[model samples]
Target: MTDDDPISLPAHDWPEFPPGLVWLVGAGPGEPGLLTLQGLHALRAADVIVHDALVDGRILEWRRADTQLEYAGKRGGKPSARQRDISHRLIELSRDGQRVLRLKGGDPFVFGRGGEEAQTLVQAGVPIRVTPGISAGIGGLAYAGIPVTHRDVNQAVTFLTGHDQTGLTPAALDWPALARGSQVLVMYMAMKHLPKIADALLAAGRRPDEPLAIVSNATLPGMRVLETTLGTASHDAEAQSMEAPAIVCLGRVVLMRQAIDWMSQLQGNPPRNPDPLGGGARTTG
Candidate 1:
């Protein structure tokens, strides 16, 4: 149990990573420690690494000295590589008998466009492996001390994106239905359209004073959490000059952050449980 050992599982028991296959791996939400053992193994064996914008650069250090690094990052309003081109590059690399690793930030299936790439690989008749990572919706919220679901607060949670292909608030989303059906909402890439999104939520009967928290640069050193109401979230975020790559969380669970912000607690602050929901009398599971 030395500190050098990252995992307790026996290394010899891990499965072999065959060549001429593309491995779609979730790099986790900005923390190197959060990367899975399978992901680390893939990095160590990958002949070519194709990474996204949100992935921390430190993770690339795990690759072999001869491993080729390729950037396929796509950021909002920034010039970047097209999705199709990246997919083609992956297929080409694997077809050349190279072990390709498509590394992404957070769970690849959760808004990471991993599905699109995987489909392309399948159509190309290339062997592929998928490794799940901790999505920002869950992992980022935890880092901010906001639970996605709590028995006393919400039994259900919904995850959505802030924008669609057209680069606007997703027109396909049924805002009113979402507002009525979901108890908690976790949105990705919503910062740019927060104003319109907030308006829709409010129009759909969501309270103006409903608690919400925006976690930016989640799990990294520069991470910032802005706690505000649905009504003021957009404006408040702008006032603070917050940037993108954030998770927008809305629900009563935001209150729990006051008492469970372990990151803050580590800095000498204590938990503050005001019991806004009046469920303090119940025992915690």
Candidate 2:
């Protein structure tokens, strides 16, 4: 193919996606374009795809015409397949000599239960391969014009799940240690327990006025971002009725959105806060 044509590697260069093998792939954070080349390859080659709720439909369009698509998604408060059932299904599909592709949203290892699934697959003696995709906490935040870290703002950032299997804020997390250790905190599945989390953080000595932003439907065309403070995050979210499948960022790096909201600039709008750092000049941090 010419330079203008789509890049297509020789078949020999691509990894073998054989029948009876299961591939666990990350679909990225809501954006079809964010899917990795390996993931795309598996999508096109698999005989059947088992996907979660966050896997974008556009990405699935790349699958082979005869490929079977299965919805194994788990949405909060919705009727969803249990994790055990999903894993067992993969094992069964492989044993049936199917090229099974288990597509998850974001990096499979990052709070995606991919490890648990992988373990189950291994225990069942199923051969598997993995392809990681950009996590929502990072890519989603970037789409919202918020940086996870900046030298002038924070030296370290922490990513954590907001709740455990019981649907409550993770009690095992050391609130005080987290508050004192990380300069930036990116939370997943936090909307449900945001109020309790905020309370724990406040009790742990985090500043109430710290900057916080909730990015919903991140990286999607309909993405929405709400800029608020730690003190009033719950109240503001409640007032706006913020939805799930969102990434919550808590740190000074959130202020960077004021200067580099590329999404707004892409629409020909200038930065709202030309001087977010309060010194009358623009800076990335």
lDDT of 1 by residue, 1-285 (tens): 123433344456665677889999999999898998889888887889999999998888877777899999999999989999999999999988998999999999999999999999999999999999999999999999998988888879999999999899999999999999999999999999999999999999999999999999999999999999999998999999889999999999998898889999999987777565666746655
* Tens-digit lDDT track of model 2 for 149-249: 87677899999999899878898999999999999999999999999999999999999999999999999988999999999999999999899989999
lDDT against the true structure, each candidate? 0.92, 0.92
Segments of candidate 2 deviating more than 4 angstroms: 1-12, 278-285
Evaluate model 1: give its lDDT: 0.92
Q: What is the C-alpha RMSD of each candidate to the true structure, in Å?
A: 2.8, 3.3
TM-score for predicted model 2 compared with the true structure? 0.94
Location of the lowest summed lDDT over 10 successive residues in candidate 2? 1-10
TM-score against native, each model: 0.95, 0.94
